[model samples]
Target chain A: MELQFKSELTISESGFLFDHSTGLTYTLNSTGQFIFRKIQDKQNAMHILNFVMQEFDVSEETAHKDLDDFVRQLKEFDLVSR
Target chain B: MTEKKAYSKPTIIRHSVGVQNKFGRPPATVPINRLDGFEVSELAEKYGSPLFVLSVKALRDRYRDLKRAFSTRYPNFQIAYSYKTNYLKSVCSILKQEGAWAEVVSGFEYDIARNIEVPGNQIVFNGPYKSHEELTRAFNDGAIVNLDNYDEMQVVEKVASELGKTLEVGIRINMDLNDPPWHKFGFNVEAGHAFEAVKRAEAGGKLKVVGLHIHTGTYVDDVTIYSRAAQGLVNFYSYIQEQLGVKLKYWDLGGGYASHNTLHGAYLPAEQTCPTFDQYAEAICPILMSGPFQAQDAPKLFIEPGRAIIDEPFSLITSVVSQKRLPSGQRGVLLDSGMNIMSSVQWYRYNFQSAQDSGTMLEDTIVYGGLCMNIDVLQASSSIPPVRRGDLLVIPHVGAYNISQSWQFIYLRPAIIAIEDGEVYVIKKAETRDYVQGFEDVPGKFITN
Candidate 1:
């Protein structure tokens, strides 16, 4: 089965996420939700990681590590593809 | 055959001052899990984010504490749950089960009290504006109707005369405290308005004066203020008895009790600043229990305490939507809940805590609600533990006013759940698209997209 990113993902201000394409919903923590929003802008992993680091006080190294793990989970759930 | 592994990645570790205590090193790790014994994450998952969870245990405990304080101090006293605080059926029902009579300000609240089966005489009708219909309903039900002004008195008299039934009424007397004065919602005693209202009710013959009611002001932490108020009421009561030969059956000190929730500009936490119920009783009960007052028929003491009773039991569980850095390097947390549900956000400095003990340092951040409005800020410059998207944030002491005063704007309000005996029951269902559209009228032309 081919997996493609769909614009059907709706992010609510309260951190609720729903993917109409898959009929599945997910909730993000404050940080996870922030990264998902950044990813929606179609930025590269490094650019997203940099954005997270600048916005949050987290170090670039920590941001990159957290972002990589988050991307892996998103891929596993078929929410995003490389 | 051996399966090939994925590419190796570096693990970035974040550091923060862990939950530490005095005497050096991190304190004994007290796990932040279930609040009041209800699992935080499980509640969020089941009820959906931005839900309101009320703890029956907290409500019962606070109610018992307040009741015991007055009942022990004063010989005769009755507590009426101020319905305006939170009229959620489940909340009111629990309070009714706890033996609290309903005290309502408007006809709507009166109807709710009636619907809940709180006896007619048990309901105290308060507030400045009472229509003829409302007065007739309350009078017919034998509810204690508190007259706010002379205009309302004439209306009551007219209604009672028309019905040919004498209705028991009370006059809300406003007295001048030491510095600040209560201007709205009562007849001023010093200005002779209260005396006039009392005289009119007595002469009407259709209205019987049975009670005297007064609510000094909101957020009153000083017991001395209430003592002064009680002294004023007692003096007024004595005057009425001596001049008009009328004895009241009850004296109502209206609701304004301060809950343990901190105020926006307070120097100390509310728990430390607010006077306990015992303190309040110690002040007012003596005046009622005094020798001269006791010599005559001691009236039943009625206290309508709303916020102090319900504020601590409820928590707003909201999911963190996003985190961003402001231009000034301040962290801003956007959550799913906003001013729509938590109306008290305008005046209260809500205490937000993490659901799980994530080993992150505390940072000062501005918490924003899901609403698109610029005024949707929930907390401006609050210190919260390092939080991320998907983390559940628990806002405590939101039992009062939030639900009763919530507004429906952009999004549907979440469900209200009551957790009791380790069981979760939905008292109110979350709103959905269909629920919003159910009332919307759509023309056929608008259906084409």
Candidate 2:
């Protein structure tokens, strides 16, 4: 499955994400920013895990656990659609 | 190697028209995470969630400030702690320790004061519903029970005659203060009923009207209202002295002082609009000190300031239970508390802040209490930071009636913690299933089901 971000959103270099549709703003941490950029590029769940395991010094299991929870939270926030 | 990132919930907020932009200045969004140096999370974790954190220092300082404000201005002034505002044993004990006379409204509140052994003469009893037994006991104990209506006056007279004791009491006089008259409590002074009642009671020869009490309204913010109410009572004081030859001992200006909580739909926050203690003292003290009452003969001033003195000393500590997006695109946050816990939120827009740093996004969020009913809302469109689940929240200005008015409905009531001498003491234990059901009896016939 692919994760796609809505087009009405903007992500800044400093991890500030603003939704133009809702006129709302949010801050993303490093992990959240990593996932948001990957999902914007239409990365699948496995590609996201592989990226966190390399960028952050985390084992494959920690990356798998955190990225799954992060993506599910993003889905809950309606920032991304599956 | 990279460090693990501190994660907050993935959050989205919509800039609605009426949510954040409100009331010129934004609502009080002061970041308050602790009460008297004790972190909110520590109190919640140790005692329970939805707890009431009361500062003993705040209570003493408020009472002393009010006492100084009035006592320094007027020659004689006495404060009676109105028990109905908050009758927790610990609160009452602190007030009594602070040199406050107990003002109870019911037989139950009177007993609470007495159980703490507040002097009977120091206790002022005022309410509409008083039984014959309660009045007899009040008079016997020399408690200054104010007569509310004719029935209560008759009860006092009957009991005084039967026990062969001359009763010295006060009468709560209701009159117009340019607002609609409150006529249900006592005899109407405007309609001459107060004059007639005093004469009749004096003629009965058993009840001596020692004082006159006037409680015009609640949340009384106007100094003019207080001035008018005091003037009206003073006029009656002169009338009673002129016609019946009785020198009134005191004037119980009943409590209605407003606190710093903003009222719903008010243009100004109560901190700005509500009259200060000094203003209230200046307005009413001049009236009592100048005319008719001599410098030495100024009838002692007795005040029952409930909310103004108590509202600031305590706060309700609750936790965010869940978050929901309302259909109207507003953020809906549910707290483990609601009207059941913070009952004053029904009228006042209390200040709520996240116990921990939730987020910087200051948005208008609707807070709901942990109840199934719709009226269980704590704040309607309060400007608060994005609160994450399990993060504790502190809501202030709840010291007045929240505890006294709190009920056990969907969930049992929460614990009450009073910060005394820099230590947390649970003055009231959190209600358990058995404590809530202790008085509930299951009939034997219905138990089979």
Candidate 3:
């Protein structure tokens, strides 16, 4: 599945995410920030999983789970659209 | 190339108003690697995941401690182990070895006592329903069968006359002690049902009323309830003697003693709220001692202790099946054990600890069982540290009602091991598909199809 971040959202290198439309701020861990940046760069779930596995010492299953969890949370916050 | 740092799952925590502060206090967690000097990992590897471990020493000690607390205060006292709480043969055998009489509520429990070689005279039969055959058997075996209602009194009278025996029986009385009254099992004293039942039993020539039984309720933390119930039992005993001219031989104050397991939604832990065994003895024994009856005429005191002696002596160890972040930004952990085996989680906030140290950061997490149902949650919310798949979680104070109430659901039940003097042995074997299917017989037509 593909995801696009809302245009009004602003993200920082320090793992802070802000949504101008909703006035809501979300704090991300380093892994969440990495996945969020990948999603913003128009990367798909497979590419994000690969990137997470290569960037950290995690198995394919764990990286996939993390990517799925991150995308689900993004959808729940309305920070991204399908 | 340098090695990459260890990875934890990505988390996007919503920083919104009224959101629970994840970083409040340090995680109330400590690694529970060993229980009763046995390694939890070793036990799980040996028996299987989701195993129950019972301490034989704890069982004997709890029974002895409760017995000492009451027997020292009241001279003519007997502790009958309540079979319904946990009727594991090993557990019952240990209590029986400690001189505890069997307190059974059903024919199945009575059969278990008899199978364990507990003599009928040492058993006190108490329950709401007793079949005519069961009453005949109990009467023939010389068990102290307590009548729950008037119908039971008539059945007992019939059985006694048919066998040409003057059977000694007891009547269970329920009264409003201001605590939650258990009116379902016994005749209500406040409503005069208890007096009427006793009078009817006296009118029946074959049945003799020799004991008075009252079960206040289950998990009673307040000592004053027992004091009031004891006082009520004493008052009723005196009335029976004056009006009916029958001297009761025993008073069976049925079990409701609370263990040190925290009840769900309670402000304080059970350790802070529940009265100790000594405190309960003090509340009960004083009233029985202070009764107007002389030393020679004092009634024998019987307290059926189920949870108090059984709860703390057992622990359940389950392995983490998986972990994930829920839509609410909370951590969710799925365990190999479920509501099928851990049924008491509905009422208790059981003490759960990790079998190994995972991390120091505490997170808001919900513990789920492996069951497919939505109600299979073991813990709705717990502030625990990060746990990986296969990590063991130890749940203590689960000895009461869990085994007897648990059934074969989706997953087969696990084994239970007993540890004593550093030696561990299986009290119950893990269930297998064949064992579960052994009771079934496929029809010939279905097999042909």
Candidate 4:
């Protein structure tokens, strides 16, 4: 099954995201917002991880952990399916 | 090439108005940042916001000041910290290190004191209501139980008779000291209730009267009020000794000392409004010494000070969640903390500071908590500098009663960090969703496979 980014994701200019499906709103920093946007663009987990690694100056292990934690949060809120 | 680029450059616009300082010198620069040479914003970035920070130096200094004041005045003075103020293990451990005995009002607090290894004799059990089991445990542990009323006196006597042991007890007496009277707890002196309780205890011969306890009220500003209270207790002590031939071992002036937190309607801050420990000792020592009872026969002085010793050293460091302009042209700054956690805000005009220098003038503003409830306001109308979202706000003088009284309503309580020796250590970790749900029982019938 192909997973598509839900239109319920509302993003403000200041990197605040409000998911209508789940009534939780989160304020993310610029870098966090960038990663979230990339994930929402129907990119695979590996592709999103690579993009984050290329964009930010961080170790591959750290990037993987951060992305995994972010995805786990989305999964917990039912914002994305594994 | 035909169309020449016409560029409109970005320009800085400054708003100016002809204004004078109507309410005195322009409100002093509201320090909207940094505390104890540490950036609050940086701390919030590393640890989450709504953080509690304790300064070991401030705590030590306040303790030292109180110790120096009482130790110099009376030859035998013992300070028992009221554990109900802030019973966080870290706080209690610090006080224990400073040679403070534990003054507990409940069995739970007594257990905490024992857990921290506070000597049984050092624990003074006080309060109006105590269960039979709690009394028996306290008595067996050799705690000095301060009996409040005649019913408690009978209960203690009955328990002592049953165990065939004479329990060491004290009677809390309420005396009219020319100040506002505290009628809720303790026996009344003028009404002869205290004398009656003492007489009954002496006649029963099962309970030994070892001390006399009195607490006037909290946030008392006048030193003379303490002196008056001491005088009243002295008069009673003299009467009891002369009539009943029993000498009290200690006189407990119960906890009511005010910390340097600004009161709700005080014109000056608490630092200026409340009397220092030295001043309080000066007022009380003379009255204690001037009585007919000398040091050898006079009861040892006991003070159960809670708020004054602990309030100034701790603070709540919260992040500014959002900022908005009210329809009435007032500014509102929302923070990550609320009255649920910072309960003292309901009675105190909490001082808020920024972590760093913003160099902005003060304006009338209201601060709100993260809760959606309108009643969760931290400050009603405060003169503060213009703040933007993400600015760090520091609420000082929150060490007393905040943690003990904090409730878990909406969001989880944040981590409490104790800053000692220029390093930050998490004394209490923030609560998580799993921690909150750990107590609930999910039955198999309610679960779907």
Considering every candidate listed, which one attains the maximal TM-score? 2
Query: Fnat of each prediction?
Result: 0.00, 0.16, 0.76, 0.00
Please rank every candidate by DockQ, starting with the best. Answer: 3, 2, 1, 4
Better of 3 and 4 by TM-score: 3
Candidate 2 docking DockQ? 0.20
Task: Please report the candidate that would top lDDT against the real structure.
Answer: 3
Q: For candidate 1, give the docking quality class from DockQ.
A: incorrect
Candidate scoring better on lDDT of 2 and 3: 3
Worst 10 residues of 3 chain B by lDDT: B19-28
Q: Which stretches of candidate 3 lie over 4 Å from their true place?
A: A1-82, B1-27, B178-180
Candidate 1 per-residue lDDT, tens place, B1-449, comes to 44332211211111235433343222212334686677889888877998898888889999999999999987778999999989999999999999999999899999999998999988989988989999888878878889888889899889988888787888898888846577787788899988888898899788889889999787688788899889888889889988888788899988788888878877666767778889999899888776235534678889999899999999888888987656554568899998999999887887887787764435557999999998999999776765668888888899889989998889999999998887788999999899878988979898997
Q: After superposition, how far is residue A9 of candidate 2 from its true place, in Å?
A: 7.3
Clashing pairs in 4: B31-B354, B32-B354, B32-B355, B33-B354, B33-B355, B33-B356, B34-B355, B34-B356
Q: Sort the candidates on lDDT, descending order.
A: 3, 2, 1, 4
DockQ of all models, two decimals each: 0.03, 0.20, 0.48, 0.02
TM-score of each: 0.80, 0.86, 0.86, 0.79
iRMSD of all candidate structures: 15.1, 5.5, 2.3, 16.6
lDDT of 2 by residue, B1-449 (tens): 55764544434443345533344555444567889989888888899898998999999999998999999988878999888989999999999999999998899999999999998889899999989988878888888888888877888888988899788878788888745666777888878988888888888899888888888788888889889887887778888888998778888888889998889998777767888789999989888775576798788889998998899999888888877666555677898886877888878988787777765656667889989998788888787875657878888889999889988788889899899788888899999999878888878998786
* Per-residue lDDT of candidate 3, residues B25-102 (tens digit): 234667888989989999999999999999999889899999999999998999999999999999999999999999
